[model samples]
Target: MTPAQIIQAIEGMEPAMQRAYLEQVKTVVGAATVAEVERLIADEDEDGLVALLSLGALSVFLELARSVFIAGARFEVKAISIPRDLGRFEFDARQPAAEQWVSAKAEEIRANATIDVRAAVREVMGRRRRAVVWPAAQQVQVSATPMVRTPRQSALDLLGRVSAQTGSRSGGVIGLPGNYAQYVLNARAQLLGGNPDEMRKYLQRKRRDRRFDGIVNRAIKAGTPVAQADVDKIAGRYADRLMKTYAEMLSKAEALESFGAGRDQVYEQLIAQGLDRDSVTKTWRDRGDKKVRHTHSVMGGQEVQKDQPFQSPAGALLRYPGDTSLGAGWSERANCRCSAIYKIRRK
Candidate 1:
């Protein structure tokens, strides 16, 4: 049957049957129409698409006619009344009362959970590609290597290779450890070492109380009693820290999947966990935030204080098990201190 006929069928169905009819249409027509419905579902300036689908309204008939003309299955779309956001609470012209203000903010938080399921469906459809596996040969070679690196080291090596191949100048790039200021500063303390470019930059600045001279002397002073084992241990520790931090953030964002949350829900939960809500507000409010934002559903939040004894951040990331998202999100506004970490998969 044509799309219009299916829509007409939906309109004619009793309220009890409307939802069921829609589902059946999905089965019959396949999922491709999800995109078209999404395009039409939220159009404001256009005439009432939702009202037309009403059982009493002839709009349903008209819509079904259109669908039939296009030779597509008909379906009904429902309005989801999500809570309004409270984060944007303003005491401005409306002068909403304090309770109203709070409610508004809360509602806003709830509203953020709103999502176009079709968007996800579209993404899934577009991403229908086979999984990747490191070849068995590669795994065998890795096993034979002299050093049995932990999973963390393996990940770091992979990251380094990715950075090298992609020529990424980002802070986390592997080989150029000194590109990061923290590592560079540590190197000056003679506790770490990094890429020459990074080291040179740190060296150009004046040293405090000839500290650099002292470090250089320590390096060259004959019989200074440097222990190769100690140096290896220290460097290894630094690498461990970097890998741990990266992995922890990455794992938390990955956890976002379990919650099946919409964008706003993610913002609220993350904010409660210690992320600055306002920061996420600004990002989501803008046109460009979606590309940079991602989510992880970690078990812990900001409640886990810095002084508190805890496992690595990776453990914390797994503390929460709700929903999360990656990509530029309306949720990751400015002043949002939440870091959404993720990696890309080539399909």
Candidate 2:
């Protein structure tokens, strides 16, 4: 069949079947080729995408190549600290372990952030109450109807519901305004999901290893290729480095996102307590380290009223750091370490 016909056939399959078929193709041609195929398909280069696939008539050659590559990959993996008997060279059992570790770390970070947020809010509220003394009559009236009396259990229940909700609402979780609850939920979800761009980079590096060039050169020079066992021995030398780099990036991004969610939850609660929106302000504070992004560094000490959004130097409007609200891109939100410092101006 023609390349376009092959593309159409693949596209017509069910998603699960399509994935399975593509995975088989990847084994034969490698991920770089598969990625190129996907890009070609997206760009409507039907003739280009199936150049590798069009060699399907040479199934014997394809299978031999697949076996050779897999043997080399498996041999390399066995020499490493990774678990043996992974069944498929491409399916590393350690990947799930990495994801699980990130998930657990995110939960821990979220919990700690919640504690810090609560303490900060309490300290601010206590100071405000102590500094403002009311007249006896007003004190009696205020005592009769205390502000910020939402029960902890009730708030938690509302938070659970709001977080699970997919739609944006004007108010949520005891009347927090303007999709604040949704923002927190979205951040948490993004954290657990990890960054797709980072994953793509990892796969690209794995598929395009320069070691393959040396293997091909040797194969061309020597009339016979190296033994599969020998190729496997050296092929996985860099696996550990790639895995470590990816894990670190995922962990850091997840932690930042979870912590940001916790801070957002605090702000939502404070807003629910009926503070004067006009009197409450939030200031962006950058860590000031060299690692801070240029866009955020310029945002340091930028203050906005409770209802207003902070405008980043890149012109992205954010409700807070790590916020995806207002359609902020991954570059603007991922691994963000800045924070919002809130203040209440008493009348």
Candidate 3:
């Protein structure tokens, strides 16, 4: 049902049910409507019928789910890096050497150098009138073809200029012969979700998680003045809140393993809000199983307990669940490790 229809359903419930519905609305609907709904529900509920309105409350949840998803999805940022120095791209430019190469190659052709006398008729001569016979050298155009330089020569010229700008060969970092820009490209590509293929779906998810973690770390290091110990302390507190909230939230939606249609729509909305959205999505893709243990062992060596479901320093609002107006959502705004998620839509 539409949001308005959902609101109306809540409104029509008994007075006591209406108050309970308002509590649900604050958590699910948003801030702007909370006061209005509360006032309306309170005004109309002379007998507290609103408290018993379970169906109406559930409908509100299903409808408002999209909005929450949208807000959450928009919580992340994405970075796109471009390729440098496309192969053979330099050939397209109208540089003299490259252009001269074309002309020189054409001149090297023997037939082009030996012009035939008969072929060189004066403009005034009629088609049937043959021109005076002359040697091929005399008749041939005197224009000489320029020498075509070898590819090696062209490369050397390029290297010579580079060397001139930065001392001699030994002055450089590595004695690499190929394009060094590729390393930068590889690093950035690896950080972003690499090629969609090659790696199965799991690899893509892992790549995305790393990318997000990198972005988060970079942002935090740049802004926060806290030391590692301080940050850890902060994260610890937030994680405690996060674990509890997720436990409660998950329980509310039992057996719902995937994002349903409305939930998927909300996920897209949250992504647009500038959150580290892909991280959240990857989290779900990587670990949505209800039975999956949070902590695990690495090669059966050191046991790495899952600290908390969400990032600790980032998860502050688990204790302050309210409608969208209170900015409870923004509590996890910049550095919160909290993830916004939804059930995946199925066919």
Please identify which of the two predictions, 2 or 3, would achieve the higher lDDT against the true structure.
Answer: 2
Candidate 3 wrongly placed segments (more than 4 Å): 1-54, 57-59, 76-347
- The TM-score between candidate 3 and the true structure equals 0.17
Q: Sum up the clashes in candidate 1.
A: 56
- Global CA lDDT of candidate 2, please? 0.39
lDDT of 1 by residue, 299-325 (tens): 113333211222223332222122221
- Kindly indicate the candidate among 1 and 3 with the higher lDDT: 1
Q: lDDT by residue for model 2 over 135-185, one digit each (tens)?
A: 343343333332331233112212222112432211111111113323322
Return the top candidate by TM-score: 2
- Per-residue lDDT for 58 in model 2? 28
Model 2, residue 259: displacement in angstroms?
1.8
